[model samples]
Target: MDRTRTRTRYFTPSEVAAHNTTSDLWVSFLGKVFDLSPLVACFQGDPLLLPITECAGSDISSWFDPRTRDIRRFVDPQTNCIRYYTPRGRFIHTPPSGPRSDWDNDVGEPWWRNLQYQVGLLSEKTRWIRIVNTLTSQEQLQEVCSEETMEEILQRYLCYNSHARSYTWKFDGAILDMSATLMENGVPDDDQELDQLGLDRDTFIPAVLLHFNDDLTEG
Candidate 1:
């Protein structure tokens, strides 16, 4: 079953960049080539609440090495700044080990919060693309995995700004306040006001769970 040896084909540097597409693009192509990529399902929430722009201007010198694969920075036709992609996996600091008295409240952390935020903004619609490559430098993405390094990454995130040509009240506010509001109020509740807005209470809370799912469900 190790396709890497049998069916796997290798791409040279030019090939990787010449036709390399986002992850989503690979999924469609993978089924035709390997028949292994599945249709990754997710909830209909705000997919990219936090953009990778936050990671810009951070001390990612260590993560930028070729070994860890923690940090990836690039400038393409999409967002103009450096796009940092890290190998972030989900972790459960707390478990829903107890009874499901309030299953809604028991939602866990989401594995893709940081990346989702970035992808969400980049992709206009609710869906985005994901591409996988063995040649993807490990050192580039490694910065997101370490706790100490992640803290540093977040600090830089707090300073990120979207140079949107349009005006909006949301971006004008402080990042901490915006993130806090999203944490406390972004989730939809049964409350009359939130219900009218079509938001769900459990929607945003589980983003903290970090490992339950890849794509988020609608909140």
Candidate 2:
């Protein structure tokens, strides 16, 4: 999912929610999404995997300390030593309590820290937009991450228009700032207001028209 070289990949919470099965598990923790299906398969039948499986398609940011970017810990009363406080039951990646000789020491990096398991960043916000091609009179309705810059959005639109980079992006007759995110470019996100007013979003999604620059750039 993070394969696009020119674009930064982002996933909405609902998008991550769709992969909530054991065979297609996805979880977001500390603002990053992880595809943990391989880990689930590797630790199949282990009770420790329960916490992760049960909370699939949800944020687990609470499990970590924001400052340290590590698991939250508490002082164990009996041992008087700090221990990871996983109220939902320990998961497969949790460090062993009171290290035992049997616990394998060669497990490599934890799933949360492994780049192989990371898919994308969790979108802070998402908005609907339409890309209208002036030359072809074509229109494509898109649900886009609000954090995307005009250039990144162009990268996303390449599937529809191979020469997207050769076009000028304009919203309301003003050339867009390619370096800034949609919000920073002054495209307001009014989804929340639309929801409050009970208005259908399809009719209100902003449109950005593309005018061909005729550079004849080749892929």
Candidate 3:
């Protein structure tokens, strides 16, 4: 008989949340979890240069992209919804001829590759969804609502509107009954999970309209 042991590679939400401190940090990106404890040590005593400490033990999936070197995505306030920016115009390309010529033309892989700090897989329940407000035409917001109520979801967006108390939520063209709890309504309670509301994981929930009541005193 042969005996061997394999390391565990999957992690639950509770397990990941437990390590959400600067000294012991873990975050998930692109479905893979990473332990950032070592990186935090490098930035110790230097809080101004880079604020990696702020992201300790937090899911930074939205903050970092592995494809491009553009750092704008990390700092943009509208990180959730997609927006197209005007191109910076074309530039002349002059080929360099030297022993290291290949390096000049090649763009390197994402920064995450250098860290090699993978820890485990992200639990499915922790996945998030991007919701858009068609009425305001504002940036989309991401929400993870496996355990939240419909009222709770509404509260999250209240800050975006001038009249927080006067707003209606719609899904698939039907107005949602805000009074009903998401769990009881059977409308996919979790943004990541599938529900009869006809929402796909990748698709955005459209037209969250806000309407203010007429001020009778003004009349």
Candidate 4:
């Protein structure tokens, strides 16, 4: 385990997709998500950036070579030489088909190689949960990365209930361990199982009832 990645944030595909746009672009490749909005702003009107814009808020793993972890390359039959196989046309960081004297060689690291642009890891799995406030009778359905713990899930619920921490979280009448993940709390994600059984996973989102603790300590 890479201890450096112990607290890595995880995002669902839809969450990434929501950032689609030239002003707020996000894309994932090789399981890592990148915010390319800055790149878009840098190359604002460049036509070569179309391929990236076309795939904003989506995964572009196919654009890279698995082993190389770089743009896919192939022998260009016309040139009889290795070349970046950008059928969508060469985008940012891609060298010209043939070198030109004007091509700036000091562009620094490519966007993919620049770790500063890396936002988070794309979630391998996501699950939906229904959070109900026992005091207010308000319910909010939330989709969260399965990698998130109950404590993190509470943060998501905060958008619906501001004083979320004032509530005692429970499932099936048992208090939950805020530090534990859903599975650690014995919550099973059966989306695939439901699909295999011809049932809609959306129809069976498990509910976590929040019982308000009359802790006047919270303002």
TM-score of each: 0.17, 0.74, 0.36, 0.90
Residue-by-residue lDDT tens digits, candidate 2, 1-219 = 332455548887888999999999999988799999999999899999999999898889999899887789999998888988899987876876787886786878877788899998988888889998888889998877877777778877899989888888887777888877777777778889998999997878888888888722321
* Top candidate, metric lDDT: 4
- Predicted candidate 3 versus true structure: per-residue lDDT over 1-219, tens digit per residue: 111123324555666677877788777666667786776665556433143445555665554455651222322254544322212211112122223533355534433454477875665554343444454556545443434444555566566664555645555445556655344444453453445666674563323333324321211
Clashes of each: 41, 0, 0, 0
- Summarize candidate 1's per-residue lDDT along 1-219 as a digit string, tens digits: 322223223222222223222222111111111111121223212223122122222222332335543344445345455544333311112123333663455345333222322211111111111111112211111111111111222332333322211111121122112123222323222334555888773342212111112222311
> Which whole-number lDDT from 0 to 100 does residue 92 have in model 1?
18
* Candidate 4 overall lDDT versus native: 0.87
Candidate 1 segments whose C-alpha is farther than 4 A from its true place: 1-7, 12-23, 26-45, 49-65, 72-219
Model 2, C-alpha of 161: deviation from truth (Å): 6.7
Candidate 1 residue 67 Cα shift, in angstroms, is: 2.7
Which ranges of candidate 3 are over 4 A from the true structure? 1-8, 48-50, 66-111, 125-219
As for TM-score, the candidate ahead, 2 or 4, is 4
Candidate 4 Cα deviation (angstroms), residue 165? 0.6
Clashes by residue pair, model 2: none
Residue 103, candidate 3: how far off, in angstroms? 20
Candidates arranged by lDDT, highest first: 4, 2, 3, 1
RMSD of each: 26.5, 5.1, 17.8, 3.7
TM-score of 4: 0.90
For candidate 3, which ten residues in a row score worst on lDDT? 86-95
Between candidates 2 and 3, the lDDT winner: 2
* For model 2, the run of ten residues with the poorest summed lDDT: 1-10
